[model samples]
Target: MSRPEVLCIGALLWDVIGRAPRRMAPGADVPGRIRHVPGGVALNVAVALARRGLAAALLSAVGRDPEGDALLAEARRLGVLTGWIVRDTGLPTDCYMAVEDSAGLIAAIADAHSLEQAGAAILAPLDDLPAWTGPVVLDGNLTEDLLAAIAADPRLAAADLRVVPASPGKAERLEPLIAARRGCFYLNRLEAEILAHRACPDAASAAEAVVARGAARVLVTDGANPAADAIAGGPTLAVPPPRVTIARVTGAGDCFLAAHLAAGLAGQPREAALRAAVEAAAAHVAGRDLP
Candidate 1:
């Protein structure tokens, strides 16, 4: 296999999602669909990138258990490089479970304790970051301290860095990257609001606010609404996503990020890249597979 052009660093685990046909209320029980698949922020992005024909490698942890072995085999089959992935013999593979309804995602829980425990060990492969000048997708699932350490690591200065919060709950953990103006951030409106500590009525405002907070660049998406792309002290652009029926919400943001990166790497202009990202996300949310 050729060397990977992109490195995705973060969670790599099984996703258990339950989807109901209607909006779910607290304690409400309804018939839904349940399935297990390989997922997690970094893994999701890596899979999408691979589907787009990009050589992406994972720099994360999985256990040495059966689940981990299966997950690794699946990743390799999906064309994602797993050689750089750390296998923790002492830790079981991680998992994430989410509940979504016709309205969208309702609740979720992430059991990534093993990954958190693995910590900086996942990055052992990249000890010489300066020698690898490639695009990196950094997931916010990593501990804040470890993220801060990476932000301070001078070796990463030569790489094209992109940071994404695994979820809105973990958005604030990206503060160090923002303060350092290190990478382009891919975020939803809610995540942007959390990181900027303010209310943003729309994706445009959210993107601007994050840029104001010293992010090198930010792309903010609002569900079924316009998505914005803003660069610090530069241009702010917004594009509306194609209207489509809501399907699965999991991994939508990751698909958007991956598509945007793919577009840029393919020489698409800024406006075109934003449009492609939004369209890709809309398709994913509508139950279309990555192409």
Candidate 2:
């Protein structure tokens, strides 16, 4: 069977992660090694999708520099389409550097300035694509204005759409989608709270709060208490993930999103999709084999 396209629209670049066996405190220098790997919500999701033997593409911006070239090459080699990536001559590929420990993520910084500054121009390439007739996995890293416009883009209403808030800080960007009834909302508990401006104790509650804000369906994930609330004539489900030692956290959410997308596209029921996503995410953070 021919696979449908999954478009990941956001920052794409190299990640420099420093791992430590134990936690670190302020001014406490730790011994760790740095490794450069392909990273970014869009790119990570694309990689996960490819790992599932799906057709995925990156519809974002990249730099004209070597990092961009190398990353693009690597993405192509992985069977992800890079033809939609806009190579800016002056802009540099963005990246995120973080320090992770045995527990989970502590403090990290994202350097996606180029992606934020590039604005709606980054999506221009998609206007002409004929093969991109499938669901687009939109990320929240994009500016609110761009996302709002996308929420109202009639061209995309022809295809299935799944939008994710990159995290808590950018969760508000997803509001337009809910307001316009464009796509399903995939958010963690904290992110769902941020979008609703309400405090929710669990994934189901967070999803209810998000649904109150006019979202048709909300996939709410809280580290282990996974719950999904739907409005498209579907059943709600609760699922739990296996506990394991934490290894990293940055790309975990992306892995979950990709797995969920793949599972749902394969006609699995909501419970199956939620379980699949949580398992994939658990495997990712635990540094186990891909789920």
Candidate 3:
């Protein structure tokens, strides 16, 4: 009856990615390699936590399709706790596809709208738990109404919440959390701007703006630039990413966030956690296995 180490709740889906060494343009024939692997914020963080030798559970909606079956098998293979996932009967499994160039991501598409409709079923078990404490990473792909509900819900309020904006389109959905000053946020410069509604020149400025918006704390990352952290009542901290060749951009931010949590949980200092996050994210973007 010890506490769960962490709960990563968000999209759990299949990712199909195509990559090419050269830059891409319209109507051009190109030779590229395609890689299909497990992805999504929930799965990525859960897998990373398991890889780091931590107990992690996934709370999200998944379909009962073949893709769901495969993902479930792999989740177990990676040692993530999947007992809390909500399996939907009618909806198909969620998925994402992206095209990447040597520079970074060129285009992407996500099919996760169904998960929005599935509501809060995945987290229902939290209310019945005997002892549920620890970090819970919440993503923004959820509907705004649902996000508001979660902000007010007693089941999740006790857990240390780490909030992430799933993507630019859903960034504004995190306003409820901002208003409630509930969780610590993980955001990129663009998503930060979307939530703050003003242009943020860098991660430092973004994190500051997030603090101004009533968030308890914030971590803002600008790709290849300096990252920043803002404690609820502490000073802003900034650190630059290590030099790395951009191979792809998919899931790099999630990797950074997960690595930060892992390092912090291991009793590392804030600077050390930031360094670990940078190294892990750099390795991910370079198409190497996480450190």
Candidate 4:
């Protein structure tokens, strides 16, 4: 396989989503659809980049199980390089379960114990690969210690990094990267608030707060509100997402991050890249097929 233009490092697993077309309440049984798909923070970003015709590789751990086998096949089908993925014999593949209704995602659980256990072993392959100067999409699924190590690792110091909190609960795990100013942080409003330790009423304010907290760059999003992007010395730019009917919300942020990175790599200006990211996210939420 050819060298990948990007490396997505983090959870590589399955997403079991139960979707209900109507509003749902706790303990309320509603007719809906349940499907298992190849997903995870890193996988989602890699898939999004691949769809945009960007070659990407996954640096993660997957169990040597049937589920892992199937997941690898699906990733290959989607054009994501899986040769660097570690296969753990003692653990089951990780998986995320979520319930979504017409309103949006309600609740979810991520069972990534295996990846957490595999830890730095998943990244060992990096030593053998050619020098990577392209964007490395990282997620908060890594353990705090491991994240801290990465923040100071010389191997990654020169690469363009784009980091995202896998979920609001994992937002604090990214503090190491934030303090190191290692990457451009991509996260939703709540995640931003969790990192900044303060309430922000809007995306622009959230972006500014994160940047002030030692982040090199930031992209803050609020569902259908406004999304903001800020660089250390540049003005924070905010743009509203195009109106579109809601379809799925799971990978929306990944789509936005991937699109923005791709646009920027293609030489789009900051404002234009942010606009394209918002547009791409809107299209994803509108049920439009990516790429």
Best by TM-score: 4
* Backbone clashes (count) for model 2: 0
What tens digits encode model 3's per-residue C-alpha lDDT throughout 139-255?
876778888888888777677788898788779989998998888898989998888789988898888887988988888888889998887678888989888888788999899
My TM-score estimates for the predictions, one after another, are 0.97, 0.92, 0.95, 0.97
TM-score of model 2 vs. true structure: 0.92
Count residue pairs with overlapping backbones in model 4: 0
For candidate 1, write residues 43-154 as lDDT tens digits.
9999999999999989899998999999999999988998988886388999999999998999999988778888888888777444667798999899999899888766
The sequence of per-residue lDDT tens digits that candidate 4 reaches over residues 163-268 is 9999999999999998887899999999999998999999999989999999989999999999999878888899999888787888899999999999999999
Please give the clash total of every predicted structure, in order: 0, 0, 0, 0
Which regions in candidate 1 have their CA more than 4 angstroms from the true location? 128-130
How high is the CA lDDT of each candidate model?
A: 0.90, 0.79, 0.84, 0.91
Candidate 3: clashing pairs of residues? none
Residues 148-216, candidate 2: write the lDDT tens digits.
887667666566777887768788877788888778788888898898798988887788777777888
Q: Candidate 3 vs. truth: CA RMSD? A: 1.9
What's the CA error at residue 177 for candidate 1, in Å?
Answer: 0.5
lDDT ranking from best candidate downward? 4, 1, 3, 2
Where is model 3 more than 4 Å wrong at Cα? 1-3
TM-score rank, highest first?
4, 1, 3, 2
